[model samples]
Target: MGERGRFLLPKRKKRRHRTAVKMVLAGILLCALLLGAEHRMRPMIETVAAYQARLLATRNINDAVLDIVQEENVQYNNIVNVRQGIEGQVTSLTTDMVTMNRLKAQVTNRVSEYLEKQTMQEVKIPVGTLIGGSVFSGRGPLVEFRLFPAGYVETDLYNDFQPAGINQTLHRIMMTVKVRVVGVIPFYSVTADVNTSICLAQTVIVGKAPSSYTDIEGGVSPFISQYDYGLQAREKLPQEE
Candidate 1:
């Protein structure tokens, strides 16, 4: 009986040892599953945080780009307005210049016409004439008064006169003259004075005489004949007679 008891005790001891080993292995497997789950959850959490940070940075960049575009548009509008104003001012100045040029041309034309009309009415005349004469009467020739287009006198005629004729009794004469422009509507008039002096005389006679008076030389008396009878007789009588 003692030997049977000893073999049963040894078998019991072996069964207790096997049960203890199985309990320890089950505890180790459970700890390994929990650790793996924790490790995987930590990586997922880090990835999500990184994505959120990228989104925030992208939003800020987009906002800054939008602000720059808005500022550029405003500056462009200002430039366009300024250019339009300058163009308008230039147009106004050009219009004024054209008007001034047209007015100047009209004034120049009128002045030219006036000067041409004045130049046409100049005249010249001989130095002797008779007009309602008393002896030593006021009469003379017409002289041209000349002026250039600039209204300055161009001739020296106002300072001198030329003699026109020679005869003692007919020397002094009065003149009345008119100067007319050809193809012009109105005429101009000018007047002057003249004087005469006789240098020689052949005879002097006074009083009247009878028509029948005769001289000893067989010629008619001087008083009884006409003053120009000597010249008339020479003309009428033939040379041989």
Candidate 2:
């Protein structure tokens, strides 16, 4: 080989090495940019997705409760037995386990079916929102993502007594539903617990009201009959003799 050829060989090798280093650095820079973009965008997407999941869960639960109650034509007197004294004074309240159990099962199954069929949803977020620019917010190329929600349903049947008038008591039979929704995105996921209560039936008892009885919104006292149905577990109300 000539001197010129030998000298050019090392120069070419050095240029190739420099090019390879530049290519690697460019690749690393691209990856960093992508990661940073994901970091900034993930929270916004997750927030939207979580809100959607919670909304979905709540709506389904409410629909299920309403459908079951209306379909079965349940009434306050059907599920509760109120005992009164000779003078028509309230003695105690009892829950009919059979009716309550059936209602709970129906509600749970309906809600589960609804959730299973409706868990997957699509959400489109504008790129500008992730950029956090007010001027361009909600105005950019839409980034679409799918949220797959998976979870379980728990139902509770309880009662609330509130004073209606001087001698009137307002008894409300309420059903509470809890749904655990885990929203899964491409590389991220969020969980949300949604709780909702609906009144199945209500009736005013015409008798002496309990002086210690207060509104249920504050909290339930130990004396009240509160049945929490956790997949068939029942809190037995004292059966009247």
Candidate 3:
């Protein structure tokens, strides 16, 4: 209640106001620091978000690309299979063409060999071979002939059958043989001329046959036929070959 008591009270009030002002300033400063930290971290957070987004987009793109690549590979495989099949067919067709009737007289060669080992053999005689017999021997197959154990072959023959008279029926012709008789005795072969009308006989030797012979039609060779007994010859002969 005195003057000193009044002075102490005023000083205490002033000190309290100063403390409150200091507390308010400190709070404002902390708030400003928090705002600055938030501002600095905002760009980093945005960057992280963008990075995550890019990663997700990349994954989606990769998945799409992988799907497309797999589809293309499957298509490629299918195309390759188709191509292989086509190639196989083409190769088969080519093989068939190349293998067509390659041998004319070889078809009966096996049978002839088998029969020759047992008895008389019949085989196709080559051109330019000689035939033995007369025209009155009787009609038979033009391409079939018999081979005896003496290495002599009696076969169908075709040669220059030109007749001087139209009424003079000529039967004999000439042909050549260049094959070895498997069953013949020590290969008894002779290269000579013979006379025959409807049939002929000749000697067989291990050699190539002539490509052509002088026939009534001139220069006739049965081996040259593609559609004949050869791979290309499909027409049936007038006589067995």
Off by over 4 Å in 2: 83-92, 208-241
Residues 121-233 of candidate 1 have per-residue lDDT tens digits of 23232222122224423347643333222221111000011223221111111111111212221221222111111111121111222234322334655454444323223
Residue 174, model 1: Cα distance from true site in angstroms:
99
| Model 1 pairs whose backbones collide | 139-174, 139-175
Angstrom error of the Cα, residue 3, model 2: value is 3.3
Residue 90's lDDT in candidate 3: 11
Question: What are the per-residue Cα lDDT tens digits for candidate 2 across 132-217?
Answer: 76897898899899989889999887766665777666777788889999999888889999999889888886665444543434
Which has the better TM-score: candidate 1, or candidate 2?
A: 2
Could you tell me how far off, in angstroms, the CA of residue 76 lies in candidate 1 after the best superposition?
22
Q: What is the C-alpha lDDT of each candidate?
A: 0.31, 0.79, 0.33
Residue-wise C-alpha lDDT for candidate 3, range 1-241, written one tens digit per residue: 6999998999999999999999999999999987885565344333333333333333333333344335334221221111113323211001121111222132224323433454543434222122223552333434333434322233232322233332221222232222222222122322222222322212111112224422223334555452111211122212223
Error of 2 at 9 (Å): 2.8
Q: Quote model 3's TM-score.
A: 0.26
- TM-score, candidate 2, is 0.80
